[model samples]
Every structure is written in C-alpha cells, then in structure tokens.
Target: MLLISRENRELLRIIEEQKPSSLKELEAATGRKRSNLYRTLSTMAQYGIVDLVRSNKRVKPVVKATSFQVEFGLDEPSQHEKRRS
Candidate 1:
C-alpha cells in the first residue's frame, strides 16, 4: 500500500501514457535527475509498486504494472499530511 506521493503518482501517469519506459526515458519525461529518478524507481521496486519490464544499452530502463492503483487505507496518513508533518 503506497501512500502515493505526487512524484509517484506522476510517474505512474507517465508509465500509463507511454506504455513502457526506461530510467533515461522517465528521467527525461519527468524532468527529474537520473540519480533521483533511480532512487524513486528503487523505492517503487522495493514496494512491488512496479515491475521491471525491459532494458537496453542505448535506451533507459523499463517497467510495467497491472494498473496504477494507490491503495491508501483509512488508517494510513494522507500523502499531503505526511508532507506537512
């Protein structure tokens, strides 16, 4: 159950729009630094938020998910609230 930050939500949106994406492609698409993007991807990977789809030498990393769903339970804090605190 991911809290679904703005960045994570945007990443999912980009994935849905692009179908498949690599690290470089996503970095470019989101205008985020490669290192930061990688960190976010790693976090998502740790949570099973995204599935690694493909990779290439010239291109960036790629991933896919059944659906971009943010499962925020009543007990969990809202992303906005988390950010505030």
Candidate 2:
C-alpha cells in the first residue's frame, strides 16, 4: 500500500492531532474498525511512518514522519551519460 494514500494521510493527521492512547480510542476517533486500523498501522510501522508502542498492554500509535520525499526518473540516459556515450 502507498504510504501517502488519502486514507493514510488522514490517519496520520488524526494520530498527530489526537494522540490516542490505545487502538480502541483511535478506532473511535477515526470511526474506523479495529481490524482495519491495526492492519493499516502495522503497514505504516513497517515503513517507519508510525510507531506502535506497547504500554499497559495497549498499543499506542505515534507519528514519526509528517512529510515524504519522492524521487523518480525515466529509463533513458541523462545528458551527461549521453555525452560520454
């Protein structure tokens, strides 16, 4: 799943603003199901976007990144490469 998807962006916003203490509280705050939230958050955790901390037997979601940087290029060679070729 893309980290910058609309749903994920919204989830990041909620986590940053509300700072819910548990998954249940996050579920209520976002109006999303526990299963779905867990799945999404787990994925985000894997990407270093958020951290799922265990406290008092509850998992707390913490935002680690609020912005993203994307860089891409076509398969064609660059001007410098063409010059060398």
Q: Estimate each model's TM-score.
A: 0.57, 0.80
Q: Candidate 1 — worst ten consecutive residues by lDDT sum?
A: 54-63
**Candidate 1 Cα lDDT to native:** 0.67
RMSD (Å) per prediction: 7.1, 5.8
What TM-score should be assigned to candidate 1? 0.57
lDDT of 2 by residue, 1-85 (tens): 7668998899999999999999999999989998899999999899899999998889999999999887888988999999997
Displacement of the residue 7 alpha carbon in candidate 1, Å: 2.0
Q: In model 2, state the lDDT of residue 60.
A: 96
Highest lDDT, which number? 2
lDDT of 1 by residue, 8-34 (tens): 777777876785446777777888887
